[model samples]
Target chain A: MASSSQIDLSGTTYCVLTGASQGIGRAIAAQVSKMLGPNSVMLLLARNKEQLSQTASLCESKNVKVFYESIDLSKASLLEMNFALNKSLEGRRVTDFSTSLIFHNVGSLGNLAVDTARMQDVPELREYYDLNVFNVIALNTQFLKLFEEVEDRVVIVNITSLCAIKPMSGMAYYCSGKAAREMYFKVLAEEKKHIRVLNYSPGPVETSMIDYVLAETVNKNLRDVFNSFKNQGTLLKPEMTARKCVKVLLNSKFSPGEHVDYFDDE
Target chain B: MASSSQIDLSGTTYCVLTGASQGIGRAIAAQVSKMLGPNSVMLLLARNKEQLSQTASLCESKNVKVFYESIDLSKASLLEMNFALNKSLEGRRVTDFSTSLIFHNVGSLGNLAVDTARMQDVPELREYYDLNVFNVIALNTQFLKLFEEVEDRVVIVNITSLCAIKPMSGMAYYCSGKAAREMYFKVLAEEKKHIRVLNYSPGPVETSMIDYVLAETVNKNLRDVFNSFKNQGTLLKPEMTARKCVKVLLNSKFSPGEHVDYFDDE
Candidate 1:
């Protein structure tokens, strides 16, 4: 078996990352771009075209090629999504790349004001899962199909959370979405023995999401905890969390489909 | 705190059970109806009206009123569902009952032929979750809202499975759906201190679902294991598992939101 060190991005690699316009996704894109070889290709996906372009520019290098596409995964039909994804590939053969990496990072917090009992809107719930769970599964399937012939190395990362296994008072949708998405990847790991699947929980990071939670969460205790994390400067920076994520990828000591949290010791 | 022994159903009670037309659901309706006191009301919901009526008749008693509603949960709009649910209540005040109970037993196995990689159709995935997760949450929210004023005993039961926490190679949809539904209920338990929430895993049972798995499962290993369970007579009878479910409700020894399996020791 190939060692973890062999997964170095300095080789010819093909990387696809979602929600890459900002936060942890952007950080991962930038940091990984620096490590990728000259022939490597990186495709960034997000709904915000301007932000995606900015992220793409930041990730561009004299060595690696970076491209960004604005695609609203939540609203796109499966057929449309496949077309967009295929267009982004630009006819690149998956077998040509020595390494293939996909970061399933697109997700949402949904409506924090609604507790489990108040979240009765079926359409709203369906839209939330479309973005956070179904789309993730669909896109992962698409990429796995594209990379099926790549015999050497393929790694799929799910940006999971502590809520995937822990229930919060007012965050039912987010928690369930994370749990479902995480379990899907775990099932993939069991089905595909050759692929490496990791559910990386990045802890409480300093992102717009934290701000949103502080402003909207119905659970006073949960809101206070997020506030304290920020006030005490304990909340991690996206870049720092992104570094830890890449380290997990490069280290690769984790069991297949293991949930590796940012606070967990290496 | 009231003792678990005091939760005896020999009182004016309102019970709403989904998927009550057959299998464990039918068995539960039959058993619970027998225990309910005079003036108790039981509402059974399922798509098969004929089967539902059969189950309702089986559950009928001189003292209790049994009603069945045939509604396709997967296709019903939120407004339609609310109307159907309200119609089933027949102007009965939630406060009129001494006890309130809900058994969320409806679920599906989806297409066993599709593995994680093959479950790429977004529409199909959404439809699966609509029946298995979203509608469950919506209906639970509706009932909880109605029972919010019942200052006494109210029990919400989720018919979950081992697959909620365990990943199966080819059953990604079923596993993810169960995990998501279970998490939602867990969140509800955390939010609602007055209500009793229990996730009951019936274990491997002698149902048509088992036959479907044996016939359609893509994973040969999983099929063989299930077949062995059947041939060895290890698969539980629906009536026996229903007895265990009622026992759990009566014992109430489990922590709120705990997943209690049929195989678990009392």
Candidate 2:
């Protein structure tokens, strides 16, 4: 493990995030806006324009600039998206923004709307991978490529899930997606020395994803856990989780590339 | 770990395998055809109809029934495939096939056609996941659901790779997809009690994929391994790998839903 580098805020910094419309993503967006410099730029992309617009409004800062895209990373072509991103990033030069940060908070646990939810080769499971894994890789690459030429550091804070390390009964697709993501970062860490990658699994947080599990899931154990989290308020707050995740990513003391869980005190 | 169930193929059996046109898949198809009882059905599916037809021709055992489908699993709807498969299996009842098995050998490491390959979000990577991870899940589910009504057993032999467990400098997508797949099986082991899943890492074999890696990969370490394997004839033959994978999958002594690497003597 190498010494982690600090992200300089005084210089204009760019923060790119996915699933930035709601839940942990929204909370992280608001926190990032406040933590980054006054003139820092944040590009928030998600499926819902309404929620994203609402989130953009919530991240209101005196000097920080925020941009939102309602595009779907899974469906959109990487070439087209990269072209548009290159145009948007052309406005801000590499020297101007000393560092660029990325937070891939987007994740899917598959469709739990049906009580008959069980693992079988299904189209929905593939969609789940697209939402949770493919989009994450594709979008991450878009940003990494965007900052590839820059001499300054580019850090990717992958908001991984605990299920990545542990096998979940019903959410195989989601668990698998996270596992893929974690491994991807591990390779990125190994190959690209200049860039930093962090696999941060933020246990369970009070988010809309959890609400979905509680409302629609047929898996008794997961349902029980979510119900308990809701009833007992055992789930961590998204704001706090966002703060801790960002802190772990930007701070200089932590290792450059490693799997760090929120529950782990270290 | 729970006790594993042996797939009894002395009675009527059905074996469905992907990437059956060549390499380990073709070998597995031939091996399975010979192992199963007379009149047992074996469906070989892959992209190339010509190669698949040739492979199917070779699997012509005296009593074994060989079938081939050139349908693209990555693009086709699993639900539709399941519906069609259900119809196909309707002619013969569950008792007709004492044990139904699936060997998912279809995988893609992506085009190592260039030395310039490096990590960045590309459409090819997403396509690779679609081919490797998504289709495997979807197709596996279709068969698992197909055997749900029967008292007979269902076993899925997922032909995994070493890349799933280790991170490679130039092959992030392949590693990530395999990781996702291995995790999926782990969850399947946890959830599905009746259906058996084996994460069988085939290790390095003398396949076309290896040829591409050796010729085009810029990664010096991987190139060296491929070179050594190619020159020294150290790579395990597809026939040997297929035999080991099938042996582990069928025998009841092994633990249920275990990730077994080829190098592991177990």
In order, what lDDT does every prediction score? Answer: 0.85, 0.74
Alpha-carbon runs more than 4 Å astray in model 1: A1-6, A87-89, B1-6, B79-90
CAPRI tier of model 2: acceptable
Predicted structure with the largest DockQ when compared to the true one: 1
Local error of candidate 1 at residue A11 (angstroms): 1.5
Each prediction's DockQ against the real complex: 0.76, 0.42
lDDT of 2 by residue, B215-241 (tens): 677677667778888899888998888
Clashing residue pairs for model 2: A120-B141, A121-B137, A121-B138, A121-B141, A141-B121, B39-B63
Superposed Cα deviation of residue B197, candidate 2 (Å): 0.8
DockQ of candidate 2 (2 decimals): 0.42
RMSD values, in order shown: 2.1, 3.8
Tens digits of per-residue lDDT for model 1 on B74-193? 876667666765776689887778788999999999878876776777788889999999998888877877777883468889999999999987889899999999999998887775
Choose the strongest candidate by TM-score: 1
Which pairs of residues clash in candidate 1, taking residues 3 or more apart in a chain or in different chains? none
TM-scores of all predicted structures: 0.95, 0.85
Task: Measure candidate 1: CA RMSD.
Answer: 2.1
